[model samples]
Target: MLIGALLILTWLILLIRYPAKALPVSGAALIGLLLVGAWMYWLDTREARQLAHLELRLDYAPTRCPADRPLALTLKNGGGSPLQELRWRIAAYAPGDSVNLVETLYDAPRYRGPGELLPGDTWHDCLPLPPFRPGYRPDTLEFRAERLQGSFAD
Candidate 1:
């Protein structure tokens, strides 16, 4: 879909650039379309895998301060190549309500972290949750991971 769209767009641009006397319509447009399509297609990595193998748990559901309330998430990569970035959307469900948060690796690239999802690789992240109250007995804490667009192989 991406390549096809680019090809059509390029052809349109080339048609506008060519002069009336140059050709019947636009020869340059045809060439431009092919070139752009090839470039975009070249970026597709066929061997890439798309899936999330994650293990989330309340490491320490303390009824105290944020530092003391420990929430850890372990992500394991069971794919062929390394994932560029892993974005996580975590939701915590308590007795009668729930709250969700988006977590991403932070360090180098834009919204990317130092962690790379390598084959058979595991990354452990410690999330700080709002301190749980003593009176509230949480029902369940659930989490889902969303891999960034360019992170997965084509």
Candidate 2:
């Protein structure tokens, strides 16, 4: 935006100082801005496009230690590009409850997964879950992946 503002300001100054060169200069500046905008738009949408092809499966099991429940994550990258990073929200809900029992965000960089997930590959790992309320066992467990974000390999 600063660049754009500077470009416009320069164009205006050029127009007032020298009208002969203003048309050609403004044309070049307009083209440059269009190309830059298009490039930025493409870069912003690349991750979302790749994420559309990803499949995630979340499951959990009872552990002897209640506080140490481990969540099993199955990630399938069906996109044409390899994934560089991933983030998702995991929420645990009890049966017949509208609110979640526990919620956590899983960040690939922080958690350190099995490295970059390649295209057409499936990666499975057991991630540690945030502790739940003591002695609060639900009759049924629910797993849902929400607000998934990921970056594709260059």
Candidate 3:
């Protein structure tokens, strides 16, 4: 796209420098600009389609677990495109007092590999929970997928 713009700019400069050659230069510049616009539109549409077809499903096992037990989850791609990477945050919460404030036993984002995730692919692994001090019992698990990436053309 940048190259196309530079070429158009150079053509315009030449057109200004040579008034007699305006007709041919203008015709070529118009065609170049139209082709660039069409290419950009195609690229944009392809990206939108890819994003629309990308989906992720995270299934956590033993939502309530002892602090000593490892947290496990299965990540599945249930879409048409292959996923490149995914980042998410998981938190362990204890029972709240009067439903106003809950004790946070653990809270952090876990970074996962950019491994290829084809449609219907499932990746299972245990998440390393952060060490917690005493007086915290994990009663509930919270999960949020923060970012996602799909495959791109090289």
Candidate 4:
């Protein structure tokens, strides 16, 4: 944005100072602004586009630990990039309830897999869930991928 503002300011100054060269200078500035806009759009949508190709499934394994129910996650990276970081949201809801009973956000700097999840790879692991209110049990749980940042491997 700063670069775009500077380009516009520079174009305006050139137009006022050198009327003869205004046309060519303004054309070049326009091209620079368009290039900046394209780069910004790509940066803004890259994460969302990658996230769309990811699939997540969540289940509870109560028998595995009688005290604290562990969450079982199966993530499939269908995108063309190697996933490095993930932040997701978990929401607990009662049956037929529109409002959520409880919600929590989890950030995993490194996912618990063999390594960075590669494209077309699936990772399955058990993770500890955040504690809910005492005696407040939810019937259904919802999962959403809040952020998925990754890069393509060379």
Best by TM-score: 2
Per-prediction TM-score, please? 0.44, 0.66, 0.45, 0.64
Candidate 3's residue-wise lDDT over 1-154, tens digit each?
A: 9999998798778878886888786888789999999999998787667655544333334554344445665676666667775554443433343221222343533456447777777776656554333554333534333344345432
- C-alpha positional error of residue 1 in candidate 1 after TM-score superposition, expressed in Å: 24
- Name model 3 segments beyond 4 Å from true: 1-17, 58-74, 81-114, 126-142, 152-154
Clashes of each: 2, 0, 0, 0
> Of 2 and 4, which scores higher on TM-score?
2
lDDT minimum window of 10 residues, candidate 1: 105-114
Q: Model 2: which ten-residue window has the lowest total lDDT?
A: 103-112
Q: Write the per-residue lDDT of candidate 1 for residues 1-154, one digit (tens) a residue.
A: 9999997787667657765644554667568899999877765434222543333334433333255335555666666667666553434444344443322334312322325666677776555544333454333544333333436533
Q: Give the 10-residue window scoring lowest on summed lDDT in candidate 3.
A: 95-104
lDDT per residue for candidate 2 within 24-75, as digits (tens), equals 8778978999999999999878767888899988777445324444677788
TM-score of 1: 0.44
In angstroms, what RMSD does candidate 4 have relative to the true structure? 4.5
- Maximum-lDDT candidate: 2
- Best of the two (2, 3) by lDDT: 2
Q: What lDDT does the true structure give each of the candidates?
A: 0.50, 0.72, 0.57, 0.66
Over 4 Å off, model 1: 1-27, 34-69, 91-114, 130-139, 147-154
Clashing pairs in 1: 48-153, 105-113
